[model samples]
Target: MSISPSLDTDDLDAREVTDGRYTRVQIGAERAVKVRAAYTTRFVATEFTKRPEDFHMLAGSEVHPEAGDVVIARVTELGKHTRLESPTSRRQLLFVGQEIMVAYGNRYAPDQFLAHVPDSLEPCHLVAGGGLAGYVIETHASIGAATAIEPIGLLATREGVVNLRDFSPLQVGSPSLAAVAALGSRRPPVIAVLGTSMNSGKSTTLACLVNGLSNAGLTVAAGKATGTGAGNDPNLFIDAGAFPVCDFTDFGYPTTFKLAYEEVRNLLAAMIDEQAAFGADVVVIEIADGLYQGETSRLLRDPLFATYVDTVVFAAQDALGARAGLDLLHDAAVPVAAVSGLLTASPLAAAEASAWIDVPVIVTYDLCRPEVAAALIPVRAALL
Candidate 1:
């Protein structure tokens, strides 16, 4: 790391080309930060809103990384993830020596990798395609090593290190989740989509429901209550006719794996409120991973889960998973409205699941029907 000659800080408006690379701006006479081929990703899109001149300084020394703390890093090695997901959902390719901007966050994916934020700005892995930088603690055997990146420094301003939460619209002066849920004296029904495990088809089921509800002449809003930060699910919901779709990331969370139960509830509540405020007739939320996962298990057992969610659509990968999943939800006192997932793709498996549990087993096409979709929502009048 080379420290160029300190430039005048008094001329805040003055722009100078430094090192023929990124513009080097002087926060003060002591600190000199340079911005080079930095590619900002989707993780920091909410708070990385500063213009080129808006005090985009970098602090290299005494770097302490925390979840949602935006940092610049140089791509050192390309492995499993060769491209990053941009704020606009574009996949930007990575190359050695190229700089990129991402956030520090923990990840929990049984089918992929489990990673945590590193204590120092040392070499770390690109644990997620959403631009999450962390050191992977564990990974599935099927996947290769994570992409590697060397930390350049933390993104900073005059106040301090720039955190995603600092500029989050949902967290800054926002009402409490309870208060938000109580507005208008009438809360819309929330259909929570849960699954047996990762890649169990939870996202597809949610999207199908969104499409079905829209065809039934009801305004639907969708949200992802927990998961590693990414744009794929939200984009799918939008294509399915959901309006004002939200996820934990919107609340400045890169991932909700280790979040407290209250935090997860608030994430769900805030998203539901945002959709309702936008005049949605109903709201649907998806809980990442399976019933046994940490956050998901705790949330289901807690009473708060029932307050905001009216029904649960259990998604399973097999007939046994569907049966076992329904049993788990039942044991947790959760109401199961329907069962759908990979098992539904097989008529034999679907029939087996239906025979095993009294709940109706449905496929994607079933959810697409206007009448079937409209019926999934428990009579709203009964709740009020």
Candidate 2:
């Protein structure tokens, strides 16, 4: 394995090795530990670790590892020396000779690895660009084999072993009751973006909405309430003119998969409250995966979620998906304000969907218009 010439090999002392004499050093804040970026949203300081046994390889990678969850891994082989997409979306190279810190997480995307938590503390694959160290139970045939990594041990300190959950700002069954009440009391008009499936133009729709709303001079805040740890979606929201954009990772969750209903509810409440506190005229939240996906479906059914969100913008891949998605939302009593997504890319498909659904059918181009956004804002009387 080759080391990057820019990095000083000597900086990593002999004691830092797996032999474990314990070297205390700070993990830099400038470069996010990709898998753990979400944790950094709340805790943005350097953390100290000393021992490998302090870390544990969690089973069942249903949820991607949250930012700040520490893992010990060894480089088993070298790849093409590509730069890793950090939690902050910055790119940096990983050297084969280096012992590194990573987080266990799962990702659900059609274009990427469909990974899971390894059942054992053994060699696994780097299944995600965000350094999701896991076992590649499945893969999109378009992409080749996953990057292999060996689990050395758990990250630890003199105090004890460190897990991302330990540093979470929110706790299970112990959400801030005041914040939840406040969220319901002073909630801003929320436009939630849901899709037929991943890559169904959810992020694109979000960006268009943010951009259009910003262009209309409305103060907007955007958030991705779920999905794996990655900088791309959040970055898009930021670039699209949203201030203080965030995602599930910001709440110290690597991914929202399989999380309890109350916990997920609290996180959403917290996120909405934080953005609403920013005094934005509107808050645009994107729910990951399709409407039928586990977390998304659960949230759609949660009464708390319905109270928080005023309107829904369903995105679909085609006319059929739009019809099905609209039907599902209708059955759940989730109001659909508009229909948009990849289907809008084709006028024929959009027209086909428009024939079936009563709401406005918006294309990517139309979604970028301020008038389209202005039309979707819920009437003040309706909130009452």
Candidate 3:
């Protein structure tokens, strides 16, 4: 797909333009692009092939772009903020009339916008803060509109397109499943934080739990096993005192949407094993989106995933969601450790959720309490 570069002559910045194979521009605050930790890595010195198809397109493609997949994009439009949020959660500004290299992928958030591969590379919108450029198919009214961007092309080398997947530190075979299983008693207990939907307070709750466990003097390794790429949640876990934090991006997936069940399971297992290898006493993991989301539902149903989870903490927006989510978990035969989420904000809502579900209703604030978090740990004997 080709799009005419949108230039506002009056809005031009006084920066010198360099002529080269790849023009250097500031990376956007996009999670998918964060795989390489671009805020720091910025750009890798690599060669590119001019063939567009050889490079991946952000929208309307079956190819699942990895977080660090480098693509050259033109700054078609500037937004109110010139800065981009880095994988480490740092924001940096961008100057118009610059050619920036970024990752290509889609983002699906019920509270934000739903974007996918654009029908063509013709200019699309930056649908996410984490530099996810795609065709915005739908958006929540609250977010208004997406940031506009024009695709220049994917970064390629003489060998082929330099996909972030090729550079991923987390490989499928590196953390062998058999090796993890060999740990046996050394594996830490895993507490999975799942939600009814995005913005349901899963990350907040996970951070609280991480904080509580850390305060209890337990070494905690935290990770987001699934979700669209972003640094926010994993960073929160780190700020909350998780010794080491990771997410699906580490495994080279830009977004977890539409991934096969086995692939999702393997990614979660690999991450869990890595945390366990870190000698953490406990691992706090958050699955992105809701239990009903495509990948999430499949993962929840997979017995392999259940093997690693010691307890399940369900987060929801309201009593209705809590009830429905609880029912789904029960039907799947997955253990339900507690009910929490946005509903915790209101005592009435929390109480209402408690009435509908038999599990304890722990608000985010209380979850930070050491004793409260300790009490939520499922019996080790039961897990056995």
Candidate 4:
């Protein structure tokens, strides 16, 4: 990729941009370094991986930014869009789990899947038109009123269905996603928690991070974009003194399994917005599923998540997984703050985790220690 000549860095204040975060600045002479963007919004530098976890977000505004170019973005909190249609019928789209289907007269019929709607969504919602298998959607796009779509094909929705097959809506002018589809000119550092499989302590680590940060005299806002809503991570964040704590429970998905990509990104954006609104100093988001799982693997290496993450903490089960996670984060340029896990009796487990991941590893036997949360702050801060 050709490097553009840098313009005046002084004039390129991060506070100026309203929507997008500056990925690479064209300043006078100096080349870009591993420095913060003018805005804190996240962008990916690259996507394809020759190494472990070398994931990136989609290509950005840069011209000819190579296929593997890393994309870094400033992640905003999750944004929520709820709609009540004119006929006293209410259509709500949570950031996750719910799909936004755009009905095309032929294949995109919203009523097509009336029988196949998930058992979880049983009793099928009584949509305005008597809940057509395909439902009408309303979008801020210049298009007219109803875009019929099968509920299952939906990636996201507010009052209208958004098809994941063509999800440009979250890109720019996505009235429901970002303020104006522009990156937040000014963004903030992000904190993320990832794990090595289901039940690997991801949410628990996130709670600890929120509590740890809050106890350290910093404002904290917590978000749970995915998960089955088994534990009360949101409640834990609130109880730990965070100003505002939230989870997909609020959006109604309460889990990440059925969510599509468009739905996930919008949910993430909405959560960021929510956190920012709370004015918290740190925003923590937890990613469910293993970092290397086939289902969520794409998101694990996702540039969106990477760009938004200031620090990434991984929960592991053993030294091997710890090593794999550490290597992945190192390749992606996401800082690994610490490793958390539960193990049987192994004296060398902590040492093994620390040596491999190159960060402090905390093994909790009590599963009820208040001090466990505090232990993470100093270790995490040191990475910065």
Clashes of each: 1, 11, 14, 65
C-alpha lDDT of residue 209 in model 3 = 91
- Assess each prediction's global lDDT (C-alpha) against the native: 0.77, 0.68, 0.68, 0.44
User: How does each model score on TM-score?
Assistant: 0.87, 0.79, 0.80, 0.49
- Residue-by-residue lDDT tens digits, candidate 4, 89-163: 233332233332111111112221212222221112212221122112323343234322222211111212222
Question: Model 1, residue 94: displacement in angstroms?
Answer: 1.4
The true-versus-predicted C-alpha distance at residue 87 of model 2, in Å, is: 4.2
Model 1 scores a TM of 0.87
237-318: candidate 2 lDDT, tens digit per residue: 9999999787776666666665666777777877877777667889999998998778788888889888889889988999
Q: Write the per-residue lDDT of candidate 1 for residues 1-384, one digit (tens) a residue.
A: 112234335455444324333343333222322322222234344334444344444444345677877777889999998988877877878888877778788899888899999888889999988878899999999999999999876666556566767655566238646446668767788899999999989999999999999998888889898888888999999999999887777777778877666777777767777766666788999999999998899889887788878999999999999999999999999998999988898999998898999788999668988787887897753221
After best superposition, candidate 1 residue 271: deviation in angstroms?
Answer: 2.0
Collision count of model 1: 1
Q: In model 3, how many backbone clashes occur?
A: 14
Writing each residue's lDDT as its tens digit, candidate 3 over 64-126 gives 334345555666677522555664567756656555555666667888777776544467765
Candidate 3's TM-score: 0.80
Error of 3 at 54 (Å): 17
RMSD in angstroms, all models? 5.6, 7.5, 8.1, 19.4
lDDT of 4: 0.44
Arranged by lDDT with the best first, the candidates are 1, 3, 2, 4
